[model samples]
Target: MWLLKKLSPDFKTIADFRKDNRGAIKRVCREFVLLCKKRDLFGGELVGIDGSKFKAVNSKKKNFNEAKLLCDIYSVLFLMI
Candidate 1:
């Protein structure tokens, strides 16, 4: 926290730093990942599960089911023909 406060760079400075060091950062990250792999640090199977529940803001009127989607597709196809 103290370090962050002391070297509190603006958005432009942060962006420029990242842009300039993009290649070097990528190389460093690749090396780090390779080192971790060599040490068997990662699991055999990586399972990423995002258990995030989002509330549906759209009402029934604004929502479209499979049947409605199929109907719309067929209507467009027929119109094109």
Candidate 2:
């Protein structure tokens, strides 16, 4: 804590450190995973990874309700017909 306070590096410095030591960091993470596996620390039953990304839309034009969804669906079906 004291060391961090003394040398409070900015975002660029931290980013540079990460870029330079990426390989070392990956090796360290791999070794940690291996150690955990040896100890049967991970449950292989279920793993959930959420990588879903959603766009930010706050405008009224982009907002919708159940009525709006049904109307849009009907419009699309009508267009097809």
Candidate 3:
């Protein structure tokens, strides 16, 4: 527990930080990945980006694809609120 606590930050801190610098952080990450691609860092590689996150109440079989994912996650979060 001690090690985990030491290595990981609380969710509030992470959330606050992300909210403050979300756009800048995303721009920097995108630039970094573009640089890597230009430099052939992932030579002949097929990259797949899935930004979907499954909610707790949603079954695994139903949680495929971006459109369905957004609906499921938002529905659960809205219900919680």
- TM-score leader: 2
- Residue range 7-40, candidate 3, lDDT tens digits: 8778999999999999999999999989998998
lDDT of each: 0.91, 0.93, 0.87
lDDT winner: 2
Residue-by-residue lDDT tens digits, candidate 2, 1-81: 686787677999999999999999999999999999999999877877799888989787999999999999999999999
Ranking by lDDT: 2, 1, 3
Candidate 3, residue 40: lDDT: 88
Could you give candidate 1's per-residue lDDT for residues 9-28 as a string of tens digits?
Answer: 79999999999999999999
Stronger candidate by TM-score (2 vs 3): 2
Q: List the residue pairs that clash in candidate 2.
A: none
Candidate 3, which ten residues in sequence have the lowest lDDT sum? Answer: 54-63
Cα lDDT for residue 34, candidate 3: 95
Ranking by TM-score: 2, 1, 3
lDDT for position 37 in model 3: 83
Predicted structure 1, TM vs. truth: 0.49
Better of 1 and 3 by lDDT: 1
